[model samples]
Target chain A: MKLRPSSLFLGLAFLICGCTEVTQIGTSVGVASGTITQGQAQSIKRSAAAVEKTFQDITPEQEYYIGRSVAATILTTYKPFDQEAATRYVNLIGQTLGQASGRPETFGGYHFAIMDTDEINAFAAPGGLILISRGLLRCCRNEDALAAVLAHEVSHVERQHGLKAIKAGRLTNAALVVGTEVAKNLTTQELAEATKAFEGTINDIFSTLVNSGYSRSTEFEADATAVNTLRRVGYNPEGLVDMLQEMQKRLKPGSHGFGSTHPAPKDRIDAVRKILGKPVSIVDQPVRKQRFAAALSKI
Target chain B: MMRKWLVVLGLLLVPSAVALAVNARMIVQVQRGQIRATPSYLASVLATVPYGVSVEILQTKGEWMQVKSLQGQVGWMHKSALTTKAVPMSSGSTTAKTGATSDELALAGKGFNSDIEREFKAKNKNLNFAAVDRMERIKISPAEMQVFLQTGAVKPLEGGVQ
Candidate 1:
């Protein structure tokens, strides 16, 4: 049967839209479960393979175009690093992290930047561009927490979420972003409803990405990917676990703050613990707290 | 006698080289689909060849095709994007797209912001072969200047490339 996007069984549907036909491949990976029929699972793999092929040969010039168009809009909306020293230092650090990470020569090189504002946000755009809001950096107890944020953002890029959104026409243009920021333009009644929708666990920005906010399971997948990424790079994988625990302490019953966009912190922490079930509780290289403190002292 | 012939030959070549001509640049529009360079599938973003800056072409693909950069890495963007634009590097002028006149000197110049309208006025004033010599230094090619000169009043020059 031709895989129809309408056949998606929840979370798997979100990952691979039911757009193609799949012939059954007989067996299933544990991840496929009841959510995916064998044919659906085959379609998902084919779709992922096709997407990889489509992205593999993008030119440096095309990368520049997407980077240029989005970078300008994002820069205009978000404050860039105010301190030149910190900006350059963070970029250098990002370069180092990128080299340490497996995919060194991405379409264009990866650039790290600190957004000038105090919003606890970090996002990765399609072309290896990472932006961490000052507020998020402030919340991190150490460099490892910062690494967790960076690693999470990296997973988003590696998974090509933005391109998929574009392919699906979920994002028509930057207008969707600009529209989100200008709440005053919304009628008072409209604003009230939006606030209600955004309150507590649902992240407004992510909720707006797709009609449904990213599922809890996708968050788990990303967290799993993040730990593996940090471990492969020789950074302590447990830093993500620690960061999740820290965020969990701050998350009140109804604090939608990060959860609205990210997963529930305590739930994620539990998930991480489950993944790391072993005698090894600490990462050999825990966050170098002193160096991180010294580096971020001025920010 | 050989030295005399060399001087005479040099004298002949110099005049033809200096013959009246103008120039222009081409900026590609991957304005859609995040333009990429592919002989087959995706549209390739035309960078200035030296230092790549993300540029949006003000006009759709122009034939004269002078790709200018804000950083000033100015050069001719060869239509080398397709099989048709593929020419041996040394074969004739790179800017001369097919059906270009031999007398036409392809311009590797960009008309910044609002220069397009003025360039057309310049081209129209010199359409007469005799007046073309005076218009040489301003150097905006006919393509960059075309729309402005195109009015119903001006009749087509009989028997030439459009």
Candidate 2:
């Protein structure tokens, strides 16, 4: 029963093509090639089918659209700051840090805006629309610390944390309107259903970002990731610790904004310190400090 | 018996070869992305590719993939902007019948697209989409970013694609 290598490849292809469902080809290929057990193949197929209509299936373009709506909703609550020079300065810092973030570019590209409100919070909508409040901006002591804040927010976008808030059932419902069988223009009824689903999706993320905060672990993870971004972008990693130390003094316990949406500053500082192992001495950068003052002096 | 099996194998080879070739193609999933002259984000833009265009992967470096477009333009693109799966494009409201498989069809501009956004906006008039549009337009050119980094003494990421 010995066969040539070409015959073996053909045998494997035969087994793969035998799969009735196109999605099962990968599993079948693995099985035919003796790479994966039958049980593993079944599990892989199940997981693949399960992922079809889930949040993971959301396309980058769709994420961009959802982010637009989310940013718009936030803008309704907090007016965008109208200072051109400051806005440009913050954007420069934000963009520079974004380049250091592992996921630098999004489908819609990264955009930064400052909110007029003095709430000590920042929002990173899916697809890279970041909204930082004036209150939060004022907390930064220097350009490095500002980089730390923007880096943290950018981490949220990079990890698609906003998309995680969408209810599983809502995603399934949304996928139904544009299911595999229907690729053509949606019927009016389908359009209506999709609109409803989109509304629910936005509300899910909005509530998590504003009223109810992310889990303590998610916040800790962002702080940890932000340190890496700061270090990678040539800023002092201790800048995150410095910003949190300052925040400890300003944030009121049981209050709204960052107090409501983030973990305590002390806890975040401790978590970041554990990752740092040794204290990262803040270096004196006259250039960074001077620009930080000039850009944010009026705000 | 050997001849009969050989015929069967030959019959399977044609379709299988086609399938293998198709699987090698990478599709651009982003709305628009620049193909750069090098793997770094700071490299000059060689060409801008739109969604649903297919490219052939030539090589890879760090988080970047070098690809050649159908028009014979070669450049590097970030891996995030591409997918191995086929992307079916629909011309607004018309059914796409370009022989796409079920998975490809499902991935077409479906859920949470512009149409749904338009519908949602029509129903809720209070949201400030104008601000969002303005925010999206505030882009920092690569040259500006270069100067900002140099002036501020910010170093590029070490050994990582920026």
Candidate 3:
């Protein structure tokens, strides 16, 4: 029996959908019918195997693990803030903002910590581990400002910017080699290769976070998302602009952490102003200010 | 000879049918989210959906999707809240009728998972897992969040100066 051209097309469609059994059956049938050559069948299988090539393919579990390691690495550089009340306050506000963000539920859920450093920086690791520097906290005048900062970091995690920073070639290579093998127990050799890939993945994220900052456009996008998230959560979007203005006063061009990692504070403020547009109404309660001050009094 | 022709016909028809069916179904990916009366977050919540509950996609407007729940309730949900994959229609039946493929399982399994993290930790001893663990332990309860929202006058709370 000869394979029909329609059958070959159907087989290709199944292969593209990553339906492994259907693809195998299709290929086998194609081969038996002489509709597809042996080489064609082999190539189809190879392409089917290449299905999980992008960063989007990283499962929630895998992202959680990556985030844990990245958080660990970050902690090696900055100590956790020892002030218990302040830490709790930040976590509450951060988590609230997270709940209102576009991508709310991650694998391990969103966790926010206040790093003891006064470097004026924030980091959002993949899988929802967020870190804010104590100095950055000092810049917030009210709960709205604090929520704005956390919202910005949440936007980064939501957008998967940290994961996007990973070199595509590295992820592609790892995905190709590690494809589906993660479900089964690995042999020692396979484990070693995957470990190498894992190391590469960590370094890629680390360098992007610590040394080379995200692109200017990416920073702008986070700022825009921050305003939107803040508004959605019923906080004033102007709080982001206020926070950026405060940072502009305290941070010089060559200062460490945020000053160096992000676009100029003035540039950010301008961008945020454009986003907010014409001083709309804000729900700024005096109670929020009092609570924010009480929480940060120890700091 | 009859069997061979039937096999050929099945292969050609099954995949296309499955593909068409799969595209119409979407599963809620978030732990919990609301199907709102409209696309905006400010819109009233019509129904709350938990993770893995399949909804049929009715329409799309920008980032929001109009979906029909199993109960026939129609509302808008954010595109980010749902996964396009067709979940097993029967919630409890664990047999292979879910239309999920082993290739997908393999794809999901592939990446920097727990095992890889263990190996990475062994190689890099200086990495501080303790701090990460401590951070994870700090959680805000729902009651705490509600009080915070109420005091701050944040929206979506049932009663508190919205």
Candidate 4:
């Protein structure tokens, strides 16, 4: 006997209702329907449950692994800054902002590194590996201003803008292959296909983060989020304005890094000013300034 | 038959009942997190929780989750800091039947892991895994952060939340 569509709806409702005996119900429905075999029904149910179709489907651990490779790739282009003290200070500030932000934790935790390059850029990899150029550090007039820059990068990771850049079809294909493979270990051919998808995923993130940059709207979102994150951490939101102002002064034609990737610094400053709703005075505390100076003294 | 319908109904009800009975548990997926006394990050930290530690979810407000640790400490953690997926409890008990589905496994670092990273690295020799390794090694302890906050008069210790 063929099962009615109404019965199918009921079955789906049962599934949504968190029925413990889903497999049994699915099998019975399939048998009653006379349209598909029990095995096909089971396979479908398993696939539905097992698949990871979008960027959101990527596990924190998977993101961490992806971030590791991405960071590695980035390192190939720039060496780590030689000053240990400066690196440590950046981590302290980054971690402080991270804890205060909406997302404090990533799978591997947030790590901050200084790239030795003079390029004025910062990148936030998928998991939490954030790299800032010494050139960007030079732009910061004080600790709070530096905090603003780190907060912006942290916001990018928090929003998963890099992950979102991955083409939808790539994730779908990866999920399909992974969901269907029931074996504990993938065969050689299966491994090869999955690896290719994995590489594509990495390439997508790298291009968005380092090469092409995110959309202007995303950069603005990061700036907005950075303001909130700065405020949450007791740093003055005006630091963002100050940093943007610094960037605006330094901007030149054909400049690479932030200048190339982001909208005009003037536009960003205006956007941040609009978000803050009023003029904010810079709170450059003596102690903060001293600490910031001491950290960068070696450089 | 009526008996079959009853069985289906029972099956449907059992899961909901089980779901309701079990207090929601979340594992700390981040490397480390603070259990704050209040929902805001500016609240005093009640405890420090590390990765894979399961906490009973008490309540949720916005992006924060109030959770109770195994030692009876209660505090708020960011929802981003925890995961609903259950991980294997003991590291040594490898084959102990985690009861996690393939989907959960796929999401929990089961398939795409260090091995894949190794293979990817072998293929791309120019990629600097060594630098990434060194970057990962730069860590700040919670104690160090506490000292930094204290010294710098940072928030969470400096009074009101902004």
User: Interface RMSD values for the candidates, listed in order?
Assistant: 26.0, 2.4, 4.6, 3.5
Ranking by DockQ: 2, 4, 3, 1
Q: TM-score: which is higher, 2 or 3? A: 2
Give the per-residue lDDT of model 2 (tens digit) for B17-95. Answer: 6545544567777767668888876667788776767787776667888788877898988888887764546421232
lDDT of 2 by residue, A1-299 (tens): 86755456656766776533544666666688787799998776655554567677787878888999999999999999978888898899888777668886687788899999867989999999999989888889988888899999999988889999888778755766544333467889878888988999999999999989798999988888888887777777788888888888888888788998898999898899899888867765788788888888877
Model 4, A102-134: lDDT tens per residue?
777777778899999878888898888999998
Full-model lDDT for every candidate: 0.43, 0.79, 0.75, 0.76
Per-model DockQ against the true two-chain complex: 0.01, 0.38, 0.27, 0.29
lDDT for each residue of candidate 3 in A106-145, tens digit (9 for 90 to 100): 7666888888887888888998999999899888877878
In CAPRI terms, where does candidate 4 land?
acceptable
Ranking by lDDT: 2, 4, 3, 1
List TM-score per model, in order: 0.44, 0.80, 0.73, 0.80
Query: Worst ten-residue run, lDDT, model 4 chain B?
Result: B87-96
Task: List model 1 lDDT by residue over B46-134, tens digit each.
Answer: 43232111232222233222333444443333232211211112123233444443222111111100122233234334222221121
Off by over 4 Å in 2: A1-52, A180-183, B1-23, B90-108, B156-162
lDDT of 1 by residue, A110-202 (tens): 667677765456666555666677766766666556666777767765555544333332122211211211112333443333233222111
Provide the DockQ value for model 1. Answer: 0.01
Any residue pairs clashing in model 2, and if so which? A184-B95
